[model samples]
Target: MSSNSPSSPLRVLVVIASSRPGRLAPAVAEWFVETTRRETERERMVVDVVDLGALALPFLDELEHPSTGVYAHEHTRAWSRRVADADAFVVVTPEYNYGMPAVLKNALDYLYEEWAWKPVAFVSYGNTSAGTRSVQMTKQVVTTLRMMPIGATVALRIGDSIEDGRVSERPMLGRAARQVVVELARVARALRPLHLAPATDGTTPGPVDGLSLSRVGEGDDVSELLVLQRSCWVEEAHANDTLDLAPLHETLADVQAWAKTWTVWAVRRHGRLVGAVRARAVGSTWEIGRLMVAPDQAGNGIGSWLLAVAEQHAPEEATTVALFTGKRSRRNIALYERAGFHLTAAPTTPDDAVLLTKSVAATTLA
Candidate 1:
């Protein structure tokens, strides 16, 4: 996504889990801001630091268990809301004698479903082990919470690196922080569907009536279809550094011709078009293309649902499915991967297009 997209920003919540005076949380947060500013030019994301020390959240104590849906305490409910609203998280922590601090653990323990399907990266500092213990322990907790823990981590050994309560030699820390931010951004975008679904009794609800799938045709609904295409192309143009409406308008004739030979579906929700997919039988393969969704309607499992429907409609003689996306569309690439497509080749154009394909049984039923 382009940094300048005029949508609601991707919210990054940096949680400072230390309450100690003169601690390294501020320096760590600064490092994060600096690194992220340089690495991500996309203005679509906004990072906010949540200082747990300043919040003075009390140790967990309640009349009921956290998993029981009885969060009576005001702080617990407020914190849970904050955690739920965030798209991604970074925990800045200090190692306390080979374990994460009790305060941090308690903070995490106060919520259950709020943390699921999100992405988390860590910034740690310590004297001996450099908070490696805290990182490991925190990973275990985050895994149980079902959040994706990214590969990048920042660890600072503060023995000689701290001068007058300020971090010295920040270049290394900056690099590490940048890596964490980039990976977190990637994973966060990948997990958007999982994160955006409404929390139920621990299960995602089946398709609702307004969100049902329907085939697209000349006589079929076209209003929502046009909106979805417009939104998707707008975002694509912004991210791929191309002229808006050029590829889309140019592809109209191709799209119409292809639609004649393909089964196209317009995904609708509440009587509005949210997404579209076209699957055409090419040789022995079912070529899926023009998979687009409204920017506001993305991250809500609509794309996956449309893909599933398209797969079910593939011709019985089809052997595989294939599609292409721009190299800059990292989110689309990851989604296609999750849906069982594998990268087939590098980009042949200057725009660096990525080709992906998925194998299917030739005799499979539609």
Candidate 2:
């Protein structure tokens, strides 16, 4: 798991949930394999794909609870093993009414811990929204299972890209696919250590002392909160090997305003301001905007402590908690994944950051 060591090949499970023959999964899967082979070969990483459509998985409804570790059905157990064995996953799905198909959701629900601590990406296709809604919904569910969904999603808009039952390759689509592959590689590399870490017993730890979670409001810690902002951006720069601090300072006011409306944790270590995290409430969902720890205190587990406090505070109101990180912040991204945030299908535009989220009530802490 050392960053410098020659890591094992990445076992990728490509789930094609759509049953329709002319659906976009074939083209999307092909694109993923082609692009992934090229990029992984350059990195000396092996890659493999599993087509779920060919697995013939049945709709979920059975005699046993997945969380209890008893899978009664044969197909369910097989699917669980497939999921458990893989190093990462890529879900090729077709959008249906601003959400993913029922079959896909059912497949995911069939297994709990088998999917934990792994990385996932999406290849989505649909009309107007281009499966953005489906991606959003899927992200919430995956996070509940403690999976790391890396930024780098491929979304294909219908009509403009389909021809005679085949999805014609657009140059732009290929480029996006390549980007997703590259990002997935980075995420897999980052999570390898955690994947190899010792498993935790099923017990949630108590919240840290002096760090309480409350709804963000007036008179809360502001300057103390600024430290998190600085820490996240500084760490982001260091991870990327860049030194631009302008964006870190420029977004202060905006982030502060965001804190006022959402739940923000004031992380006090030994009764002194050290770090903080601010999550904004958007509709029924909450997005974590600023999660930072003082640079000098990062490895001391302050960030992880703050994140646990925030998750405990998030569940009663919001359906999910989402956040974005810089593509280059390898450590931060892995930390977020370990905390149960999953990546969704959102293009990482120069200004549009990488998005990650977890379902509030659906996820458990251990």
Candidate 3:
């Protein structure tokens, strides 16, 4: 996991798939990126342009299967990392003999797991067929990698859509390009959980049975966390006998702001965001907050499991771990008590809230 702030943008990589000396792939890619710049920024996406002509990957030379992940050359490793880091991909390609360029296929063949469970959009250009056949051939290969090929695409006929070696400026063409990116973003986000949490083969220890836990990363969306916090805090309002609560009232912007300073962990079960917790070392004490589990997922020991996971992330210098809850929220207090926390007096806490603390040997946690 990359451990990026929850509000970080989706990483959309634009790939120019022609390596010939005088090729129009780069121009087409640039036009698409510029055409969709406004929507990309509005949707909180980050675009990175990758020109395969500059990458210079040779024909497949590794002896091992790509799934084994053992690359014999530095070029393969570099390409692997680039593709792995992307949340979604847009391949700008030109038809070659009515099929995708061999270089594009070679690039796709360089890695296995890195490409799975992500969305791919295509902007294809060529003659009469407008490169639709190339897209069809590429779709067959991409599906084998578990990459979803979206229905929305940009198809440009070289003669009709290009002018002076550049894609012509036209409102309808720009709109089509923007629509492809918009739909790609939608599918990218929708399929993010699958990309984040792959099916484990039961060899490694996890937070709980059937639950996958990992550090939150840059491309992870915080909208789900905001909704989970509000849903979980409603119970606290009833128990505490007051409507004034930070979690209950914190806007999405507020949550995003706090996420920057906190090292957060997200928990999932079967591809659903089920729980999350954030912790940061405050002086010698580790402060843990925003611990939550979906309402329907409560009472399955997820809260306790998540607390243990959060504590494991505490800093070495921290001798104490602390958290706060509504003063009258007995259920929360009881849960904390079972995890070795004790109610403590704090002058800085609001009258309606109570702080809890637990001492742990710094050496052990370190």
Candidate 4:
């Protein structure tokens, strides 16, 4: 699937917020999705229907705060991924006692950063108020998550607009539903910058929002980094025809020990550690290694951007930056060369690995 960035196709998650048996939420969501299908495809928008009834998520059960992004259960992580993958949202809901459904609120409370910087639209149904109060209540919670709630909405009074548990196929209603998607796409594009976490030094923003960069430490960062390294090096392992790679074989303790001496940095996107790199001065040359980006996010210039960031952390006494990869790793070599590193002779490199180096001045000037 393509990313939900400004330059990529937009992914709209249609959330059916009611789990009650025989509820009309699914019908409402179906109407919204079908109405927008043709126009959405033409405009590079993908609508995914997610029904709370089918998902069957229980009440929130995690131990840590949602803001921490440390999920103890697979369900929470799965939920995080779905939310993180979306660029916008459209909720199909019914007002209950003049407010949003409790299940909807629980789902919203389960994850923090995933919902940040996205736009949410509403398709509501109820009696007298046409579920407008539910939307009003949801808007308040979504705003607190840094989500943008657009002005376009569809409110349906069951007595007037619904038939046999399904929304009536009215042309005006169809137009309104399509308009909701149109508005969501525009707002998502405008709010893309909020996805970027500003640099800690306040010099520049991150490549995407919710980026938290810091020295590697305890509390899941090391374990997450370890997992990322193994995941990212599979391609390298295949390219080199070897399973002896340290990145794949290294233990958690190995990573922890190295972090104590190396100037290690981890980049978390929306509380998930998606990239990392480590560097330390080896005499006059800065030995930078273990640079990795999530495979799904590769080819987006994150690796290159992260490599440059690692260089900036080099000690003042360092005159060169050096790294290594398997000899047959063409893609890695090409990326390095583009970043101004050249393959160099080094007998000290591992049996199947090759070294590359660049003068600090050239790298800095570039």
Candidate 5:
């Protein structure tokens, strides 16, 4: 999110909220982006435009609601990714019978957490109301989804601000557009910490910000964990020169069964499952398995922190903690080594993998 750095260029997604033929939303959105270009560049902001008309999203067709984020269709997934990638948003719209457009509402209803902890601004054009009513109606819905709507807005009078179906090049509106971008950037940076999970009563703070760790439960967490496993082990499959990694092929049922037996912990960022590791005590040794981190989050020290969490929860009677990885997974090996684990003679280990262990007494397992 926010281009890998909280202080990096702000990603502002401008949404064109009208889908009707010859709609003015595109022209309005174009004007907003162009007018704000100078301030955005000066403030290290990046602007991207999304046209609801071109996107052609149907009325909330997914069986599961946006709250679950279990997107069943490709369109929903694509939309979710785009929204999640942005740190802020701007909507350009026209009044629809004194409310927001149906297309805009539909697009907003397609995802949930992706909209959380971000700032949004609006530019509205209409007859008597100048689309201010539409903006008010949208703010209610966006607020319920956890988006922060700024005070800075641009409301256009179609009768005065339009010439030839486009916004007239007016200095007043250009200045207003700049204000919207500036206000959005300020609010977004202020709200950035809300996206991060600081220390909680029972949970230890992670290495980086925005991490929440918890035991795996019977919910969408299992489904998401199953997905994370398949994704994180692609490198393991490649390194071992085989597609035979269990994590790469484990089904939902397999994961569910294991959760019933092992103490499985997961790491979530903004409600997305980003990393996980599971372990169980076996004959004086705590056997840790299935260490995983989302590909984009692999280098963020999440895997190491998750390992520490597993160790911290290990049975006190266990003498050592152990895990296994593909022998060629040098990255994983190196991480374990730095954590004070080392390879040992594991006669039961599979041919393509090696067992690694660290004495529980030597670790901070409290």
Candidate 6:
């Protein structure tokens, strides 16, 4: 899985929804990706092909509900990661018995949250109805998963669009395929806030309207966190007039290694990683570190919100939360001070850094 910065390329996964041997689905998908390749590059987006045949996911077998995001099998976990990492989807489906194929249906049934709040477009091919009946049948299922299906679509009749079991070189059809990518990109960008907002199961709402707060996952979020951490600390290095900042210099491996010892929370708005913080219990004190918010997203109380969240995660035996920042980072120091953090006069503190500590009462809850 690839991580996305706000300025990085958007990920659009094109799903070939057929699994039979010698199927036309691959050829159709190839045409669509080639047709849209130039446009996707120009728009700062990436197109990935996911053939259901290659995936070979079994029928839904997990005993737990998909909404829990608890997969009992390795295949389900891999599938969940792939779907969760994508910003949008384009399903290349074919009609079967006047409806969607069983493989596509089974694939959709295997996960829940991975499909939510993203845009999906359909490129369907079949003998009659241009495989539109299959698209119609799948639309209701997508809606139940909180997915928004776009209006632009590509429907091809086998007799008219296929030649020698391949999609023919029709200019109009190629243009329509490109248009599907354009529309999907626009709708996916527009609908990103829905994808980023925190889940509704008593999750805390962020200070910003569309901001989401959640624990970071291992594979998909690690790289994004590394990018965000570096992007955010560039401002700190400038403010402090020093190139010795730790966050600005940490590698991907360092971030991954730290996650094992820390409970990390990521913040997103409109499907873009904007802020993050990590904390862990060090004996009786909850040690918080690496609090960051994007330079453009600052002054919105995200840092304070994340700090409160980290403090809330402290163990019952914890009596104080502690952190350190650049000595010249006055804005950050003020924010921490307002959150009841006071300068700590520790003898071992770095010469260029200021240490801050906040007392945690037993009844304190975030």
Residue 90 CA error for candidate 5 (Å)?
Answer: 0.2
What is candidate 1's lDDT per residue for 1-366, written digit by digit as tens? 111111345678899988888778788777667667856556456787898888778888766655433455567656765676677899988998888977788888887656777899998889888888998999999888777889999888888566767667577777887788788888877676554422211123222335645677764655445545766877777767775444456444545555567788775666677777888888987878778877776654566556655665667777788888876776676556545577786555335578888877511211
Measured with C-alpha atoms, the lDDT of residue 186 in candidate 2 is 79
Tens digits of lDDT, candidate 2, 49-145: 6566666677776665665334555576566556655667888888888889887888888877567666899988888988878989999999998
**Model 5 misplacement above 4 A:** 196-366
In candidate 5, what are the lDDT values of residues 220-285, reduced to their tens digit? 489998888898888788878899878878899998989888888888887788988888999999
Least accurate 10 contiguous residues by lDDT in model 3: 196-205
Best by TM-score: 5
327-355: candidate 6 lDDT, tens digit per residue: 88866775565455678999989999999
Better of 2 and 3 by lDDT: 3
Once fitted onto the true fold, the runs of candidate 2 whose alpha carbons sit more than 4 angstroms away are 1-6, 197-366
Give the alpha carbon lDDT tens digit for every residue of 220-259 in model 3: 7578888888999898889888888889898878878888
* For model 4, the run of ten residues with the poorest summed lDDT: 196-205
Candidate 2: which pairs clash? 149-343
Per-candidate local distance difference test: 0.69, 0.65, 0.79, 0.79, 0.80, 0.79
Candidate 4 segments exceeding 4 Å error:
1-5, 196-366
- What local lDDT does model 3 show for residue 83? 76
Assess every candidate by TM-score: 0.53, 0.51, 0.58, 0.59, 0.60, 0.58
Task: State candidate 6's TM-score.
Answer: 0.58
Best by lDDT: 5
> Least accurate stretch of 10 residues (summed lDDT) in model 6?
193-202
- Higher-lDDT candidate among 1 and 5? 5
True-structure RMSD, every candidate: 17.6, 19.6, 17.0, 13.5, 13.5, 17.0
Clashing residue pairs in candidate 1, if any? 3-42, 3-43
Model 5 lDDT on a 0 to 1 scale: 0.80
Query: Where does the lowest 10-residue lDDT sum fall in candidate 5?
Result: 193-202
